[model samples]
Target: MKRRRVPALLLDAAAIVAALLDAWVHVDPDDRAAAACALLAAISLTLRRRLPLLTYVLALPAAFVTDAVFATLAALYTLSSLTRRRSLLVVCAAAFVTGDTASWSWPGPEFADLTDSGNLITVTYSLATAAAPVFLGQLVQARRELTVRIAEISKARESERQLLSDSAQAQERARLAREMHDVISHQVSLIAVRAGALQIGNRDPETKEAAATIRRLGVQTLDELRHMVGVLRASGSDPVELTPQPSLTDLPRLVDSSGIEVELHTDLPADLPAAVQRAVYRTVQEALTNVRKHAPGATATIGVHHTGGTLRTTVTNTARTRPALVLPGAHYGLIGLRQRAELLGGTLSAAATPDGGFSLRLELPVQDPG
Candidate 1:
C-alpha cells in the first residue's frame, strides 16, 4: 500500500474490516478480554507505519493472545518494509511469529507442538502464514532500491554524454579558426601591399588620400581576420599551415611602401625571437594604418628600444594635414593588436596625445614563456 494521507486512511479501513472479521470469527463474543485485546491491536495497526517499531511493540501481545491476524500481519509487513536493518527485522519478526502461533486450538496444541510427531505440517502452515507479509514487504523494498540505483546510473550517463558533446564542439571551433587563417591571410596581405603601392605612385592631394584610405581599409580587414582566427583557435579548431607573419625585418619595407613621411629610430637587439619581432611589426602596422585612416598626410615616428630582457616599441604621428573619411571599423584593429601583444607576454597601448596627435606603444619579453 502507498504511504500517503488518503491511502493511510483507506488502509486503516481495510485493516479494520479484516480485523473485525478475524476477531468475530476467531474470538468468542463472551470473552471480553480477548475481544478487547483484538480491538487494541486493530487500533495500533492504524499507525503501524507512522510509528515504526512502536506500533509493533504494542501489537505483539495482542497478536499472540487473540486471533486478529489483519492487524498483526499489517504491523509485521510495515516493520519489515520500512526498517533498513536486516538483522533487526529478522529478529523482531521471528519473536512475533513464534509467540503468535504458539497457542493453537487445532489438533491440537500437543500434537502440533514444535517437536511433536506428525506436527510438521501444521507447524509449517503456521510458519508460512506468519512469513507471507514479511516476505512480500522485503520484495517490494528491494525493487524500490533497484529503481533508485538505475536512475542514478542514467543520470551519470547523460552527464557524460553532454561533456563529450561540448568537447567535440570546441574541437570543431578550433579547426574552423585554423582554416580561416590559412585561406584569408595571403589575400588580405596582398590587398594591403597593392594599396600601399598605389599610395606611393599618386601624390596629388585627393589621390594620395584615396590611396591611403584603401591601404588603411586593407590593414583593418587584416586585423579583423586575425581576431577571428584567434577566436577559432581559442575554440579548439586546428587550421592548416599559414604564410609567415611579418616580423622586424619586414618593418623597413612596411614603412617605405606606405608613401607617407616617417622617421625611424632603433636600438633593438640584433638577435630577437620571431614572436617578439612579429608583435612589434604588427603593432607598428596597426598604429600607422590607424593614423592613415584618421589623419591622412600625417608624419609618423617609429622607435624600437632594447633594454635587458624586455623590448619596447612606439609609434607616434603628427597632427593631421589632410582628413580621410572615417570608415566604420568594428574597433577590431586595436583588439587584434592587443591579442598579439598578450600572446607574446607583452602589452600594447594607443591613445590620443595632448598635441592632438596619436601614440601607440608595445612592450614584450624577449623569450617565449607560454
Candidate 2:
C-alpha cells in the first residue's frame, strides 16, 4: 500500500496548536516573560522546514523558562532531518536537554539537586526526549536516500538492456547482408561465365551481341555486390568464412550434432540452387535451435521436398517432455532467418501447433534450367 504525504501547512498548524496546548498546561498565564517566550516558540514552528536551526534556537528560551517543550523537540527533529552535520546535531540536542532539565524560579532558571534520584531521573528523561526526535528524523532521512538509490539502479538496468538489444540487432543485420551478397554474387558470377562462353562460341553476329550485353551487365552487377560485401565485412571485427556456406548437404550433419531426437526426410532434387538450399538449411537450423531452447526434450521432424515448381521445407516439434532451462539469448534467430528467406524470394511462417507443439515452414519458387 502507498503512503500519502501530509501537507506542510497542515503539519505546521498542528505543531503550533500542540505547542500552545503544552504551554497552557504548564505555564501560568500571569507570567508575562514565560508566556511571551512560549507564544514565540509555538509560532516559530512555521519556519521549521526551511529554517530549522533558527527555529530551534528561538524555541530554546521557552524550554528553559517554561514547560512548553514540544515546539523545541519539533524544531530539533526538523534540523536533524535537513542537515548531515553530526557535531551540530549533538550540540543542539545537548542544549535542549540542558534547558529542559533546569528548574524555573522567580529570578532565573537553575539546576536542581544533581545528586538526588529525582533530579537524575529528570536528566535521563530529558536526554531520552531529545534523542527521540533526532533518531526518528535520521531514520526518515536514510529511508529517503535509499529510495533514490533504488530508482537509480533500476534506470541503469533498463539502459543496459536497451544497449544490448541494439547491439544484437546490428550484428544480425550485418550477418544477413553478408549472406545475401554471397548467394546473389554466386548466381551472378555463373550468369557472367555462361554468357562469356556463349559470346566466344556463337556464330551469329546478333547472338554474339546479346551474349556480350548480358555478360557485361552481369560483371557490373557482380562488382557492385563485391563492394557491398567489402563494406559489410569491414564493419565487423570477427573473421568471416566465405566458403563452406551451409546447404542441404550439411543438413544430415546439422541434425546429428543438434543434440536432440530429430527425424529428417527429404525428396529434394540434386540440382537445387545454392540460395534455395541455403534457405532450407538456415530455416531448419533456426527451427531446431528454437525447439532446443524453448521446448526441452522435444522430438522434431524435418521435411524438404521439390514439387510443382516450389521447394517446401518444414520443421515440426512435439511438446516438451521436460521443463526448458532459462538461458540468455540475443533473440535474433527467427528474425534473421525470415529476412534471409525474403532476400531469396521465399516466404517463412512460424506458429504454435494445436497439440502444444510448434511448426516453421518455408516456401521458395524453383525455376528449372532447361
Provide the overall lDDT of each model, using Cα atoms, as 2-decimal numbers: 0.78, 0.87
- Write model 1 residue lDDT over 56-132, tens digit each, in one string: 77777666667666777778788888878888777777766666657645555423366765466656766787688
User: How many residue pairs of model 2 clash at the backbone?
Assistant: 0
- The runs of at least 3 residues in candidate 2 whose Cα sits more than 4 Å from the true structure, single-residue gaps closed, are 1-6, 106-108, 183-370
RMSD to true structure for each model, in Å = 13.3, 15.2
Instruction: State in Å the error of residue 147, model 1.
Output: 0.9
Best by TM-score: 1
Mark the regions of model 1 whose C-alpha exceeds 4 Å error after superposition.
1-13, 104-112, 115-118, 203-214, 223-370
Poorest stretch of ten by lDDT in candidate 2? 1-10
Q: Cα miss at 282, model 2 (Å)?
A: 27
Rate residue 60 of model 2 by lDDT.
Answer: 88
